[model samples]
Target: MTDLHAPAHPGASGTPVPAVPEQPGTAGTPGTPARDAVPAEKTGEPKRNRRRVRIDHLRHVVVEVREHAGYRTVVRHAAYTAGGARLLTRRAWDSRTTARHERMMRAAEAAGNEELVRQWEQRAYAYRFARHRRRVELLQMAINAPKAIGYATATGVGTLLILGFLITLGTGDTSDLLTPIEAVVDFVGWVSFLASVIWEPALYSLPLIALGAAWTVGRRQHTAPAWALPADAEDRDVVPDEGAIIKALSNLGIAPLNKAIKDGWQPRWVSPTTRSGPGWHTQLQLPMGVTVEMVNGKKKVLAHNLLRKPVEVWPTEPPKLPGTLDLWVADQGSLSGPTPPWPLLTEGTVDYFKGVPVAVSQRGEPIMGKLMAANWMVGGIMGSGKSSLVIALLLGAILDPLVDVEAYVMAYNVDYDPLKPRLRALVKGDEDEQIEAAVHALRRLRDEVTERGKLLEELGGDNTKLTRELAQKDPRMRPKVVVFDECHELFMHKEHGKEAAELAVKVMKKARKTGITLVWVTVSPTADSIPRDVTRNTSHRVAFAVGDHVANDGLLGSGKHKAGVTATTLIPGEDVGTAVTVGFTNKPFEVIRSHYVAREAEKGVDEVTPVVKRALKAYKVGDVWEVPETAAADVLTDVAAVLGDEPRMLTQEVLHRLAERNPSAYLEWGPTDLKAALEPYGAEQYKSGGKSMVSRTRIQEAILDRLAEADEDEGDPEI
Candidate 1:
C-alpha cells in the first residue's frame, strides 16, 4: 500500500540512488513542497507507525486551523464588546470592513509589497464570500423550517376537514368522531360573533372620528408656512428639526448631554418652539452638574458643532431656573429687527425711583432697571447703537417727575440736541472748555456726594444710604442722574485724564448712597479709557457689539464674558441696538433690544425732549434753571463775593454762607473740603491770626490762570 505520510527520500542506500521528485508544477516552485505531501523515502516504515504519524499530523493541522479561526472570530466580535451588539446587526459593519480592506490594500500597494497586497485582496474576497454564503443560509433556513412546517400542517388539517365533510355526506352517519369536529366549528363560530359584537361600537363612534380628523387638520395647519412665497425660492428661514438637532448634539460628544442619555439620567428633550418674532426656542432638562451658564460658556463651540452662526445661536436660562437651558436660534443670521417704538411718556405720572422700562427682552417682555442706588456703564463699538441705548435709559429717568438730568457729551453728536434744553447741565464739544467743564462737573458731583454723606450721617439710620423717606422729606435729595456720553474723550485728555479718572472712581464708589446715579457711555471700552476701579464699582452694565473679549469684560465686569454675558458676538451695524445687559432683569444676563427714540421736527427736539422738559418743570423750582458754566469759576467768585470788605474769613463762616446760598450744594463743606477743592487750581488756605482762612488774591490769581489757559485753548490752531 502507498504511504500517505511518507518522506520523499531513499533511506540507507550506500549508492545514494536518486529518487523521483514531485513535479514543480504540482508541488509549487522548485524550492517549495506541497503542503499535504510526504517524502517517498519514509514509505518503507511499518504501516502502523505511518498511520500513527499521519493521524498526529492531521490533528496538529486541525488545531492550527482552529486557533487561526478563533483569533479572527475574536477580532470580529470586538465591535460588539466596544459598541454593544447593535453594531453586529447593522449593515454598517459590512461597509466598514470593506472600506478598511480597500484602505489596507491601497497602503500595501503604495509600499510596493505585492505579496502583502495580494494577500489582503484574497482575504477580503474570502471574507465577503463567506458573509454572503452565511446570510443566504440563514435566510433559507428561516424560510424553510417554521414556514414549511406551518404550511404542511395547515394543508393536512384542511384536507382532513374536507374529507370528513365528504365522508359525512356520502355515508350519512353522525358518529362520535364527527361530534368533536362539530364542537370545534361551533366554538369558532361563537368567537367570530363576539369579535363582531366588540367592533360594533367603534363603527358608531362619530365623535372620536371627528376629533381625530380635526386634530390631524390642525397639526397640518400649524406646520404650514405662515407666508406664501414663489416656487423655486429657497426658504432659508425655516426652523431646524429638533430630532436632527438633538442627534447632531449627541454626535458632538458634549459630556453632560451624552452622559445623561447613556447613563439613564432621565434626559428629556423638549420640542422646539417659535419666538415671538424670528427665533426658534428649545429647552433641555439638564443632567446633574450641568448649568445654563456652563452651556452658555461653550456657545461658540456648540454653534460650530451645529453648523450655525454664533450670533444665531443663543443659550440662556429661564429667569428663575438655572437647570433648564433655553436656547434661541435666530432664523435670520442676525437677531435684529421688529424693535418696538419707544413708549410715550406720561406727564407728571411715571415714577422712576423704583424702575423704568428701557427695552424689550427676547420674549417681548419689557426690561426695566432701577436708577436709584445704581450706577450704569454702557460700552460698545461705533455705530452699535450705543447712543440710542443711552438715550433710552436717559428717557426713562428724564420722564420721571422727581429726577434731575445732567448730560456731558464730549464727542458732540446731533442726537443729544433735542434733550439739551431740559438738561440742568449740558456740556457738549471736544474743545478745552468742554473738557474742563466735564472735569468741573465731576468735581462738583464729588462735593455733592460729600454733602449728602454728611446729611445721611445726621439722619443716623443706614447713614451711608439715602432712604426714600428722606427724599420725601427733602425734595432736594431726589434722584440726580448724570450721563457722560463719549466719556473716553475725558479719560484721553492729556492734562486732566488722570484726575478725571480718579474723580470718576470716587463718584462711583460714594454716590450710590447719596441718591446720585452715574451713567457713563464710551466707544472705547478699555483699561486705559475706563479705569478698573470705576468699572468694578458700577452695578449696572450694558455692552453692545465690541471689538473683543477685553473690551467686553471692561464694559461688563472682569470675567463676565467668560461667565457667558458676552457682547463680542454681536455685529456692529447689523445688531444695532441689541445688547447684553446685566442687573436689568431677574436673569444674570439678558439680551435686550432698545426702542428707537425718533427725533422730533420742532426745536431740533426728539421724542425724549418733551419728556425731559416736563420732568424738569415738575421737579425744579422754576420753568428753567441754568447751571454754572464752570464750577471752579463760580466757586472762586462766590468766595470773593462772600469775603467782600474783609481781607480774610474763617473757613467755617464761608462754608456757612455758601450753605445758606445753596444748601443742597454745600451742606457738608469743611476746612479740609475747601482746601482739597481749591488745591487743584493752585489755591491754598493759610493760618491768618489764629484762624484758617482763604485769600481773595490767591482766588483771583487762580481764576486768571484758568482764564488764560482757556484763552490759549481757544486760540490754538488745532481747535
Candidate 2:
C-alpha cells in the first residue's frame, strides 16, 4: 500500500527524486494502479501565488485613505487652527505697539513724502502718550485696591446692619436683627454650591470653544495651504481686501516693489474700499519706485494672486497722482455675463452737445462721451464687436431727431437693416461701386463742413463754434454724424483711396467745430488700411480685440503698446464688445464693455426696429424749431400746447409730449433747449418731488408777456 503513490524521500546521498502521478488514460497499469486520486484544481491553490500581492494590496489601501474626503477635511481644519493662531498673535502684537504707524512712516519716507512721514510720526507719538497714560491709571488703581475693598466691605456691613435695625423696629421683635445676616449667608452659600456644580463641565468645554473660534477665524481668512484646502477653494469669488492686494503686489517680481514690501511697505489707501457699480473700487498709493505702469504691466499676475481671472481686475492711474493705482475688481464671471439693457431702449433721449451713453466702465458706471466736436477711430478684427460698438453709437444718435446719421458699410450684412429707416444714406456691399459711394459721401461731408463754417461766420456770433440755439433755429446747421463700417475697403481702394483719405482728414480737422462727427471703423488697422492722417486727427480712439500689438497701437495710438495701454490683452471670442478706449476718461486709457444690442433676430424679438421707427417718425416731421411764419409764436405757446391741462409735468416728459405734439418743431428739444426757451420770459424749470418739473402756469404767464411785448412793438411805431 505504501508503494504506488508515495513520494520518494532523500536518499543517503541527500539527493531528491521526483514522484509522478498516474496519467489520465493509463488508469490501471500493472505497477501503478488507480486509487481514489484527488484533483489539484479542487484544492483551490494558485501555482504562481507569491508575497508581492499582499504588499500591493496594502499600498492601495493606504492611497484610498489618503484620498478620502474625510481625511482631507481633517487635515485642512488642523492647518486652519495653526494658521489662525499665528495670525491672531501677530495682530495682537501690532495692536500693543506702534508697528503699524512705524511701518507706514517708513513707507512714506521711502516714497519721499515728508508730509506723510511727519503725520505718522505725530500719530505714533499720540498713541504712545495715550498708552502711557492708561498704564499709569492702571498702576494707580492697583495701588488703591486693598483700601478701597476694605472701605466697601465696611460700608456694606454697616448698611446691612441699618437695614436689620429698621426691620426689627417694624417687626418689634428682638431676634429680627439676626434674620437679615442669616439670609445673606444663605445667598453666598447657594452661589458657591451652583459654581461647584457648573465648574467641571465648563472647564472641559472651554478648550473646545477656543479651538472652534480658531477654526472660525482661519476659515474666514482662508489660512489653510492650497494643498489642504478644498479643490475648488481657489475658484471662489473672493473680493479683494487690503491684505490680498498687498500680497498680490508684493509677489509681482518687481525688484523694487519686492524690496519695499520686505522693508514693511504697506499700501497708503487714498480711498477706502467702496462698492462702485458692480464691483469694488479703491485707490492705493503704491510704494516708492513702484509706478502705476509697473502695476498695470503685471495685471494678469496680480489678478491670479487675488484669485480672479485677468479680465476681472482693472488697474489704472489716478489723475495727478503719479504713484497712485486706481484699482477695481469685478464680481467673478460678471464681465462674461450679459450687461444691463440700453437706457434708450425703453425711454431716453440724447443731447448731442452733452454726450451719449455708449458703454460702461469696468466698475459698471455708465460711460458717456461727446458725439459732437469729435472724431472717433475704431478698429478690431472680425467677430470682435467692432460693428456692435458702432451700432451702439448710432442708436444714441437716432434718438435725437436733429442728428442725421449716415452709414456706409462696405462688408454689408443685415445687422444694419433695422436701422435703415432712420439712416439718412445707407450704402451696403463691398463692390467697387459701394467703395465709390463711400468716398463720394466723404467728399460731400467735407464740403458740408466748409459750408457750415462759412455759415457760422456769416451769423456774426462772437463764438466761432456752432451753438445749440443757432443750430436749432437754422436747420442747415444741424449736427451730422457719418459712420463708415469696414472703412479699410474705402481707404485702401486703388481708384478712390487717396481721395477718401484726404477728404476724411479734411472733414475731421475742420468739421469738429462745425458740428460734424466722423466715426471711422475698420477690421484691418494698418497704415495702409487706415491712413495715418485719419488716425492723427481722430480725437477718440477705441480698440477692441486684435491679434497683435501693432494693430492695437494702430487704433489706440502709436507708442501706446509700450506705455501699457494695449488692447492685445483682451480675449478674442470671450471679450466681444469690450474695448480699450482713450479720450473718454481723464486717465491714460479705460476699458469699456459696450452695451449689447442684438443685431440678428432672436426668438422673434427685435431691439432696433421699434427704436428706428420712432426716429423715422420724428425725422419726417422735421425740426420742431422750424414753425411757419403764419404760425409764428413764442416757445411759451408751444409749451402751453404740450402742457395741456396737466398742472405740472416732468421736464423730460414735457419734452416727449412736445415732440409728440409737433415732431416737426420739438423733435430735437432737450432739457437745455427748453430751459433756454423759458429763460427769456423769466420763467425756469424747478424741482418738484425731486424731479425736474415744468409748471403750466409759468408757461401761460410767459405767453402773456410775449403777447404784451408784441402789442407794444406794433403800437409804438415812430413817424
Candidate 3:
C-alpha cells in the first residue's frame, strides 16, 4: 500500500504518483498518515541554472593604467563600460519548490493549487510596484521643491535689476549732473536720523530691503511644514514592527519592496511591518483586490494588505506619524505581589518613565523622545488608586534623570499627617494658612508668568519654542510639576479664591514653555466654585467614576457629558484601578487596570490627627465676616410666601392698564401684585408677564427707612 501523497520516500524521485485530497470526508484526517504525504511528482530536485550577475572587470574600470618601462600611463577606457559594469538582475524566477508545486498541480488540477499560485504571483507583483512608486514620489518632490529652480529664479531677477541699475548709472548720471553733492549728504544725514528716530529721507534702504525680502523668500518659505498626517481620517494607524512584516512576506513566498516595484506589482500593505506615525498618508496606489473598483470600465490594480487599529489623530500643520506610542496599558502587574523587572513586566509597552520606543521605516534612528511636561492633573475617588498613582508618578520621576523632573505636592486636607514620611513636610497650617500657601505659590507663579510674557513679547514666538530655548540654556533647571490633592479646600476657602483663580489663569496662559504643568484633584465642584475658563482650557483631562453629570461636564465636554454618561457609571470588568485618559486632542481612552508603585512607607498616625484638628480649628475659628447659614427654602419661601400671594402698590403695569383692563377703584392689587402672586408659576406657567412682589420682611424694612428720612410739616398741621 504505497501512499501517493507521500513523495516517494525522499531519495526515490522521478516516479510519478497519484494525488490525494485532504478534505474532511476524504483522506485529510490527521490520524490518516497517507493523507499528509507529499506526492512523488514533487520529490525531484530542480537543477540550478545560473546567470551572470557579477560586475565585469573591463566595464567597471572607467580609467586604465599599464606599467611599462618603469613608467605608468593612465588613460580613459574606450567604450561600452556602463552596460557590463552593473549586473543588476531585472527579473526573478521560480525556485525548486515552485517547480514541485507546479508538478503536483499539473497532476491533480486542484483549485487549491491554482489559488496558491495566484496569491504568490499577486504578492510578487505588488512588491515590484512599491519601489517604483516611491521613486516617482521622490522625483515629484524634487520637481516641486528644487533648490536649483529657486536659485535660478532669484539669480535671474537680481542680475537683471543690478544690470539695469548699472546701465542707468552709466547712461543717466542723475546724481552729479542734476543735483548738488550737498543735497545727497543732507539726505544721507536725515536718513541716518530717521533710522535712529523719525527722519526717513534716506533712499539707500530700498535696495537693502529688497535684498532682505529676497533672502527671506529664498530661506524661510523653504522650511518643511511642521506636521503631515494621514488624510481622510480622524485617527492614526499603528503598524507592527518591521521584523514581523519581513518574516511574514518571506514565508508567504512574496518578493519585498524592491522586487515588487521593479516588476510593477502592488504588495499587500500587511502588518508586522514597521509603521510610520500619523503624518504619512499612503499616496502610492496598491492593488486593493476587488474592494476598490473604478466606476469607469477600466483596468484596476489590486493587492492584499493588513491594517491595524487606528488611534485618535492629533492636530498639526503637516502631521507626522509617530514612531512609537504610549498606550495606558492594562493587565499590568499587581502592586500587592512581587513585581517583575520593567522589561519583563512591560515587554511591549514603552517604559513608564522613559516613554521610548523604536521608530518605524528608519533603521537606527535617533530618538530624543517626548517628555511629559512636568504638569498634569490627576483625580479619582478615595479607593480609585489616587494615592497609588501619585506614588507611581513619584517613582517614575526618580527614574528619569534626563528630564530632571522635580515634584512639589501641596495637600490641604486636614488629615495630611499620613504624608509626613513621603511628602517633604510643610507646616501644619490652619485653613487660612493652607489657603495662603496656595496663594503664595500662585504669587511666585505670577512673577514667573510676567517674566514669560515679557520673554514671549521680546522673542516673538509661542511658549513651546520658548521652552525648548530655556531647556537648552539650563540643564539643571528641570521641569516642575505641581500636585494638588483635595484642592477643593483651596477654592472652598474664600480668601484664596481671587489669588488662586488669577494664578490658575496666569500659569495656564504662560506656563507651556516654562515646563510647568498643573495637576489638581477635588472631590466635588460647583458652578461658582470651580473656574469655568480653567476647565474649558485644560487640554488633557481624566475623569474617573465621578458623582454626577456636572462633574462629567467639567472634565469631558458639556454635550457628551450630559448625553449618555452618568456619575455612577461603573465599568463592569474593573474592581479598582479603572479610569479614562484623554489628551489635549480629547480622545477618550478607557483603562481597565493600571500598575502603580507599592507603598514603601506611610505617614505617622498621631501627627495626622493633630494636623486635621489644627486645620479644622483654624477653619472654624469665629470670625465677624462669616455668613450665617439659612436654609435654602427659607431664602426662597417662608417669610417670602406673603409676597408670592400679595397685591402690589406703585406698580408700573397696574396704573394705565388697570383703567381699561380692570376698571376698578378698589384696585389694591395692581399688575405688580398680580405678577407677584404668579411667582410660584414658571415662565410658561404664567399667562402674562409682570414684576414679582417683594418679600413682606424686606418691604417693612424699606418702609421704616423711608419714614425715618421723611420730612413732616408738623407746624402747619391741619391749620
Candidate 4:
C-alpha cells in the first residue's frame, strides 16, 4: 500500500524523495507541487554581509576616537571659548540695561516678598532716570565743548608767556621770550610721534586680548560638558554657581523638572549662594509642576551632576519661604570626616529643661535634644553604632544628678558598666530572668507615670504639666529616664512579648507629661520587633544605618522614606555614629554625627570615667530618686524612716528593725554595714552612753543640709 503520510524513501540515485499530499485545487491542474518545485542548488548556502560588518567596525573606531584624551581636550577648549563669549555678552547686557534688576524683582515676587519687589522697582526706576540724565548731559557737553576748550587754551598760553617775559627781564636776554614757545612745539611733536608708533599695534591685538579674556572666564567657571572635561577635573568639586545648580536640577531624572527646563523655565534665586559654615547655602523657588520632593528623591543623581558626594548635598524645605527649596552643598569630604569632640568632655553640666547637645549637624550646628517630656525610638542594625548614640544620650541625662537613669541591656554587653554606680538600675544579660526583669521595669514605670500624674494634679493652679521646679520640690516626681537596649529581644520573647509591648505602649503614651522618658533601642526594625504603637507615640526618632525602606520607615515614621529623609542611605560601618533624626532638633529633621564616648577598656576613661565619678560624687545619699518597685531599698532613706522620732537607738537594734522592714534588701546588714552606708552622708554611728548608737538628730540634720545644698546648687529651677 502507498501511504501519502509516510516518511521519505531513498531513490535509486541515493537522493531521498519527500512524499506530497494531494490538494483540492491543484491535484488535477498543477504539473508539480509547490514544495517540490524549489531548486536544490540554492539550499543551505552561507551569505557574507560585508556592508554591516564595515558599518559596525566604523562605529567602534569612532567611539574609540571620541574617548581619547586629545579629542576631549580639543572639545573642552572649544566649549571654553563659546561659554566665555556667552558669559561676557550676558554681563555686558546686564550692565547696559535693567535686566539684573528685573530678574531680582521676579525672584522676590516668586518668594512672596513684596518688600523686596518694591525695593527693586524703586532701584530700577532710579537707574533709568540716571541713564537718561547722563545722555542729556553728554549732548549738552558736546554742544558747548568747542567754545570752552578755545578759552582754556588761550588762558594757559598767556600765563606761560607772562612767565617767560618775566624771566627775560631778569636775565636781559630777549630771545628767552621765544624759549617757552619752542619747548611747547617740541613736546607736541614728541607726543605725535609716540601715538603714531603705538596706535597700529594696539589696534591689531585688541580682538585677540578680548578672546583670551573670554576663554579665561569660561575655564574658571568650568562651563564645558562633563564628558569633555579633563580626567582629573571631571569629578572635581565645583563652586555651586548658578550654572552648576541649573545643570544639576535639569539632569535630576525628574520628568517635570526636565520638561520645565527644556521649555525655557529659569530658577528664581530667592537667596544667592553664600558660604555657610563648611558649605554653601542657597534658596531656590522651583518652577510650576516641579516640587522639592522630586528634587530630594534624586539627591544622589543631582549631587553627581554638581560634582559632589550624595551626603554633601542637602535640600530642605525653607520655613520662611514657602514653596521654595533650601539647598546646602557641603565642602568636599567635610561631612565624611570625624565630628568634633563632645562639648562635655572638657567641662560642662546639663540642665534637662534647657536640653542637651547630643550631636552636631552636617553644617556644624549643635543639635539640642530635650530629654524631659520626650520619648525616643532608636533603631539600627548591629554594629551601626546605635549603642554609641544611646550612650551619648545617657551621659547627657545622667550628668544632671537630679535625674534618675536606668538601663536594661538584653545582651551581655559591658559598654555601660563604668557608669553602674551612677545608674539606679543597670541590668545586662540574655537570660530569661533578665528579659523578665525588663518587663517588670516597664510595669513599674507605668505605675510611676500614674503616680506622677496624680502628684502634678494635686499641685493645682495651672501646674497641669510637670516642670523643673516641681521635679525639684517633690521627691518622687524627679525626671526619670528608662532605656531598653536591644529591645527587640524583649519584644519578640516567646513568653512575655505581648504583655511587654502593651506596657511599653501605655508608658510611652502617658510618660511625656509626667517627667519620664522611655527610650527603646532595637536592632531589628520590623513591625514584629518594634511595634507600631511604640513608634507612633515616640515622636522623637533616631535611625542609624538600616536594611531597607520598610525598616527605615519603621524606625523613622511612615512616609519619611518617600519624603527623601531616609537613614537607609547611610552606609553601615563608615557612617556608624551618623544618624538621621526627626523631632529632636529645631528643624523638622537633621542628619547628625553623634558624639562618641568610648569605654574604659578602649582608653576612653579620660572622657567618660571622669564624668561618671563626678555624677556619683554629686549623688545625695538620702535624697529620694526614682527606683523600681522590685529594686532594693535605699539604706540611708530606710534608716531615717526606721528612726521615726526616736532620740537615739543602738546600731544592732537598728539593723534588726531594718531587717524586719525589708528582709531581702537589708536582712544581712550589720553595724559595720550601717556605718559604711552613713559614712558617705557624714552621719556615722558614734559611742553614746555605753554602746555604739546612731543619732537621730545627726541623720535629720544631714538630710536637711543635703536638701539645702541641692537648692543652692540648682538655684531657681528652670521652668
Model number with the top TM-score: 4
Sort by lDDT, best first.
Answer: 4, 2, 1, 3
**Which stretches of model 3 miss by more than 4 angstroms?**
1-375, 398-430, 453-464, 467-469, 472-477, 525-529, 562-568, 571-574, 584-592, 601-719
Best by lDDT: 4
Would you list the clashing residue pairs of candidate 4? none
Total clashing residue pairs per candidate? 7, 4, 37, 0
Q: Give the winner by lDDT: 1 or 2.
A: 2
**Residues 1-719, model 3: lDDT tens digits:** 32536541111111222232232222344244432434433644222211110111111121111212121111111111221121111112233124433433332222223544554454444545665788899899888877878987788656655665675677785443333334545888888876777434446676666455444432222111111111221221123223222222223332233233333343432111222322222211223221111200111111111132111111111112121111111111221222222211121211222332111111111111123432444455566545544443433332322232222334533333343333322443436766677677767766875665565555545534344345434443334445556666666666677668778877876676555556666555445656766666565555555665676666655643422322335332243444444452222332222343333233432323332232222222332111122222221232233344454433333233232121122123444344454343321112212222233444445445445556454444685
CA lDDT, every model vs. true structure? 0.68, 0.75, 0.37, 0.77
Q: List the candidate 4 regions with Cα displacement exceeding 4 Å.
A: 1-189, 196-237, 248-273, 282-299, 315-327, 603-605, 624-719
Give the per-residue lDDT digits (tens) of candidate 1, residues 1-719.
22445443211211111223333222433233234445434545455554554544444344334336454354323422333323333336656467656766765565355766775687687678777998999999988989889998798667767777777777788463365467777988999999899887977786567555544543322222111112343323245445334544554556776555444444454323434335667666678866767676677776765667677777766544457666776665545665766554443234545556677776555566668889999999888887777777777776655567898999767777777766678888988899999999999999988888888877755555776567665666767899888888898899998999999989888887788999889889999888888888888899999999999999988877766678998877888888888877656777888877767743555577667666556544663332212233267777777777776777767876664343324544666677888888877677654356888788888889989999999999962
Full ranking by TM-score: 4, 2, 1, 3
Q: What's the C-alpha lDDT at position 402 in model 4? A: 71
Worst 10 residues of 4 by lDDT: 44-53
lDDT of 4 at 570: 80
Q: Return the TM-score for candidate 3, rounded to 2 decimals.
A: 0.33
* Of candidates 4 and 3, the better by lDDT: 4
